[model samples]
Target: MNPFDNILDDEEIQELRKNHNHLRIKFNVLSIFTIIFIFSGMVLFKREKFPTYLEDLLNQPPNRLLHNINQSNRSNYSNVENFQNSLVSNLNGGKGTIQLHSQNDYWRESPLFDALKSGIISIETDCWYLDGQDYELFIGHYKYQLTNYKTLNSLYLGNLNKILDDVNSYNYKNSIEGEEKKGVFNDDPTQTLYLTIDIKNNPELTFKTLQQNLEIFQLKNYLTYYNTTSNEWFKGPITIIISGENIPYDSIKNLTIRNTFIDSPLYEILDISNQSNHSEFELKYSNQLSIFASSSLEKLIDYRSSSLSNYDFVKYGLNDEQIQKLKQYISKAHELGLKVRIWDTSINYDSLYNSLKTNIGINNKGNNNNNIIWNQLKELEVDLLNVDNNVDLLNNDAMIAAIGVSNNNNNNNIKYHDIEDNYNDINSNNSLS
Candidate 1:
């Protein structure tokens, strides 16, 4: 070390050390830049691939994000204005009628509101009147399911009254002098929304309670009623239909004028004209007393047969004989000036048998059975298509195809009958019926 120090000058040694330090600093800076460049390249590659990956992910079934997006796109009306706009735009000029059934667990107020928003024309609610309660009708499928807050007045009638008040008041304020008052729908104000009430217990007491509850609507002139004095039935925004066994026909049948109408038994339509063949209940039904004739689909058609499989029924729909029987029932009801509504058509035999075997009540998840039944019913010209679950009806592709009109279309002049014709045309080549 001493010999090297002597041979080299101090300045030369210092210069050598400075050059080495500069090279070391340059290498460190280059290393950092190389790392940043690699990271940026990775980010760019991911960005390019992400969209396709996301699309693939969305295409997969049961994807929550995709489901949410579809739901929003299907039914995005979150307010009154949006709902009204959607209703007018999607309306098929009263050609087809859809009735929302209150069979699901979520039947309190939200389902009613959702149905209205979806532009459904008819709605059904099951009611029970408590012995101790005063003019209060509770809504639930069973006695054990009833809650104190969910009442016919609070949930349905009160809300309906309020909606009518707002709509009618606004309409009156912008009146055209002597024109008759309009109903809920802006496009077709005269179209009355049917409200079906299925009484669960005590027909007399429940009927009385329902009548008392409807006083507000009656006062507001928002209810459909028949005027015996004028021998005419006046159309209003809402029509109330009562359905149940042991109905107090005596109470309302004799009344000179009344708002509430009865739901006649469809099975007894064949014997209605023949007084000798008519039962006590069948004798009470008339064009004045009832507006809708209804029965379970099974009562009209023999869908349950050991020889035929459930899958075949779901695929092929009603056979020739069944169709004839159904046609006769519908024709008779129509002849009597009563609309026909068939219920218990959404049955999934496979699911039902499985449920029976399992002893666990699970909801039918697939709508193939419902879709097939609805198509046949539509082809048959059922006035009100009773649907148990309408959550995805407005947005379902199959339903839209069945309707033959898009809900998003801006064309306001498309009549429902035209849509029906279009549907018939589309299915003419290969119809389930």
Candidate 2:
């Protein structure tokens, strides 16, 4: 259509057309490539360009898997579930704190009454509305205890809001936090409190009431409910409880339930076994399990005690062959998604400084394998490590030889299940020098 079009020769016109066609093809290809590059850049680089909260998700414990007293999935039972459209934890992992018990064993057929008696601030129970008028929430009997209230009744069964109000109204208490001293003269408040509820059927409406109560109470955060063969009170809180310790689940984030024999595995075994014997013991608490104990190297040092020698780990527990096994244990722990802490059993008996006294080192002679341990700790981002040298931690005899921290839970404190067991359980609560 241009003025030059008619005047141009056929050869020039054809050549121009050919050049335009080639340019057109090149332009199309370049456009496609540019679009793809933009898209790929967004997915590959720009996606992570924003400050993603990867640590907040990764560092926290799982909620559905096994939530403790402080954590409950807000999304799953949210007053505002849809507000946070994210993954599991990010969606529902924030609750303030629910003051409840976590005794590992013994619960009633109807755990509801346990909640009422302040025997347990929170509990898990099965609801069976077998009766036409009511559904019984079974506690210790393994059979539904009939109740007159409907499932929707706030008194018998209700939302978390009411459950919490009830807990506060009842003046339920958390007994243990810090215990610097233990004896017949001292007292232990973190004992298992038990109460029985007989809900005679009428469960349909009553179960609703119970659920309402749970939600009202926000027992999800402070209380843990578990099913049991009978309705009885059991030990609550799997983690350590110290006297005067006010550590709430809301404040403390990094928590762990260590297994027995890692260092003091025998103690755990004994405690669990003893709990099983009691008819009132309830085993349905949180499902998280892993053992935190002294390393084999520390265990060997414990055995040698005053007679420990250099390279004892190689001779007793840490040879090249065994060292590989240690790495395997570490790897397995990681696979299980457990946060591991190194138990410095040897620190309780001797000092790391003493071990390095005679070691041959670098040109400076002061640097050696001990430094390697420190480097490993820094490199591994260890949660805890210990030194036996009391002086190394700045306190000689005043502090418990723990991971150089003043956490109250580190102090030994004993708790009892019944008032009568008070005297017998005192010594078990004593802290070691």
Model 2 lDDT per residue over 203-315, tens place: 23543433344342222233322212222112322122111112122211122211111112211232443575542111111122221222333542234455444544411
Question: What TM-score quantifies how close candidate 1 is to the native fold?
Answer: 0.64
Model 1's lDDT to the true fold? Answer: 0.60
Q: Rate the local accuracy (lDDT) of all candidates.
A: 0.60, 0.30
Judge candidate 1 at residue 379 and give its lDDT: 71
Pairs of colliding residues, candidate 1: 92-416
Q: Which one wins on lDDT?
A: 1
lDDT of model 2 at residue 205?
Answer: 51
Clashes of 2: 97
